[model samples]
Target chain A: MRLSSGDSIFYDLFTAAALNLRDGVRVLSEALAPDADRAALVPRLKDIEHAGDEHTHDIVRRVNSGAKTPFHRDDIYRLAGGIDDVLDDVEAALDLMVLYRIKEMPTGIAAVVDVLDRAADLTAEAMPRLRTANELTKYWIEINRLENEADQTYRRLLAHIFSGEYDALTVHKLKDVIEILESAVDGFERVANIVEQIALKQ
Target chain B: MRLSSGDSIFYDLFTAAALNLRDGVRVLSEALAPDADRAALVPRLKDIEHAGDEHTHDIVRRVNSGAKTPFHRDDIYRLAGGIDDVLDDVEAALDLMVLYRIKEMPTGIAAVVDVLDRAADLTAEAMPRLRTANELTKYWIEINRLENEADQTYRRLLAHIFSGEYDALTVHKLKDVIEILESAVDGFERVANIVEQIALKQ
Candidate 1:
């Protein structure tokens, strides 16, 4: 399906929102425990969120004005929505890191961060596939698999944290980070779910 | 606007799914501590996951086969997807608790759980409100406020955790759980995001 200018524009907005979130996570990771400027970083995170909202509005307005939608209205809306979920996951993580003043990433936490990066990559990679429903099937499968990997990682990380290796406070901090990262993965998994359903329809 | 029989059925499927996920969370809260009978409880939890999938399949089937959707095709799909998200969020929390062998709830974690419960309730209550998009707006607002509250509590919890009252492992463990629960609130927050967006379109 050749998406109309409106659909393409909407995707661009979604992609931009996702990239901002990805960048936000990267910023958090780059900062050392004491030097993390969450104040500076969080505003940028909210920018991505607001961008998502604005784009959602654009999509809906155009949708109502009788613009030609490339796919079913439901598909376009869900894709837009899945993008919001992805961004929220990232923003939420940044919020926790800065608010808690989480100084250092625990040993297992870095792994979850890696997982978030990979999932973000998948999300980025999946965008072009949305132009054609046929291409979506393979990307959809891969995203699902990546999400499964995230699940396994989340499980292993939780196990290690609870192994009583770290102190109680360390346990709390690391767990907060892990949970946020895992939710981001869940966001990716959800995108996969919507795509799979869309693929069947296509 | 009168809802079609198909629409009613579709909504019921999601209602059942949300209830299942909500119950799953309660089950997890009880089972999370070290004393949980994993041998029996794990299977039951797995059952909840399976049941959720079954509902997802049912939704997909109905969408694929049906011609006239009760509401807009997009609304039906969004409703279905949102319901799935509720389950996914709950399942992730439960799975992590079990995997980590987290014996008991950390103090901050309870606050996060309360937020999640509130969000879930908002979603459940808002479902019928879709019949009147105006009421849905109220649900949207409340859920957003709750997410904000959860956000505040989360930040406070993290600050306290980092305030250095506990040891390293305690910090680590509580951090993980609190973040998970926070993200769970964010999950409901995400749903609220969707409903609010929908209301905006209306």
Candidate 2:
């Protein structure tokens, strides 16, 4: 086992990245709220996404620098990349909402956003527990469950969007936002699956 | 060096999958034509997608069965999954077009579809060369270039869709189709990146 005590820093970086994702999702939830200042929140969410990139870069550099890692370096890279992908989606979702100048958000979007918040929370909680691989099973299982719930919410929302309540333009804007949110949820599931693979390989 | 002559079978499977992708893109191009009978083409594209899935499954089963592979098993899995993801997007794009009953595609769509066709060609051509990893750089480079072109075309189409020429419902439907097409291009880039990583590791 080449894992040295120093390798624990990787866990810290991952935790920071996951927590950054949680922050991004928080701002996303805020942006989705009616009467919220979405334009202002866009930059704030951008800052969180930038913070996530730094963590991802740090982890990538550490792995490439030939530092000792707790598990497969490939898994570490994938885990970091997966988390970054989610954050990117979250940021994009909010950016789209602001860009589209959407006057009204459709119904059922809140359910999907709530699912993202819960998924983010679970991911942040799972990051630190990655060090003890076996204990992370519950984390991933829950993420899978959350993702399933999110999928249902997403489909329902899609059906609602196309149900002719909003104008076509509004439906288009809302569809873009919700699709990105659903992708974020799916991204969390990918991250969790990576953790599970790491654990199983361990 | 656990590699044997039998390992060449993986390359064959990959090539078959790549060819399947080409078939998919051909059908997709037909479906995009102004005179296309898109409804009839849907099941045909779905058939291509199903074939791609079988190729992916075969590769996974072989890798999991402990067969000697040319590169990392994980990369093999990712390569297969990446190709599968592109096909999924292609099928979804057409599916959305059919479901939305989109009568007329925007002007710039043909350009974006052209880029996808070219990218698919490059990928199919590159797959057989995976055995000689050193020969694969040009493949990925061209893929990157094509993706850049596809990105620009996609953006222009988006601007056009929102340019107020089309009605709101038409804009929404066109946005959905073009976005998925762009994703298919991005998916090819990812697959190329994975192939590059495999070569570099080798």
My TM-score estimates for the predictions, one after another, are: 0.55, 0.67
- Total backbone collisions for each predicted model: 30, 0
Query: TM-score: which candidate is best?
Result: 2
Candidate 2 clashes between residue pairs 3 or more apart in a chain or in different chains: none
**DockQ per candidate, 2 decimals:** 0.42, 0.24
lDDT of each candidate versus the true structure: 0.68, 0.87
In angstroms, the error of model 1 at A46 is 2.5
Worst 10 residues of 2 chain B by lDDT: B1-10
**Tens-digit per-residue lDDT, A68-159, candidate 2:** 99999989989999999999999888877766677667667888888899989988988888888746878888989999998888888888
DockQ of 2: 0.24
Candidate 2 C-alpha lDDT tens digits along B25-100 = 9999999999899999999999999999999999999999999988889899999999999999999999998999
DockQ of 1: 0.42
lDDT per residue for candidate 1 within B70-163, as digits (tens), equals 4666766666676676666666666666676666655666666666666666677676565467577677778888888887887788788678
Off by over 4 Å in 2: A1-5, A26-30, A33-51, A64-66, A71-78, A106-165, A182-202, B1-69, B72-103, B135-138, B141-176
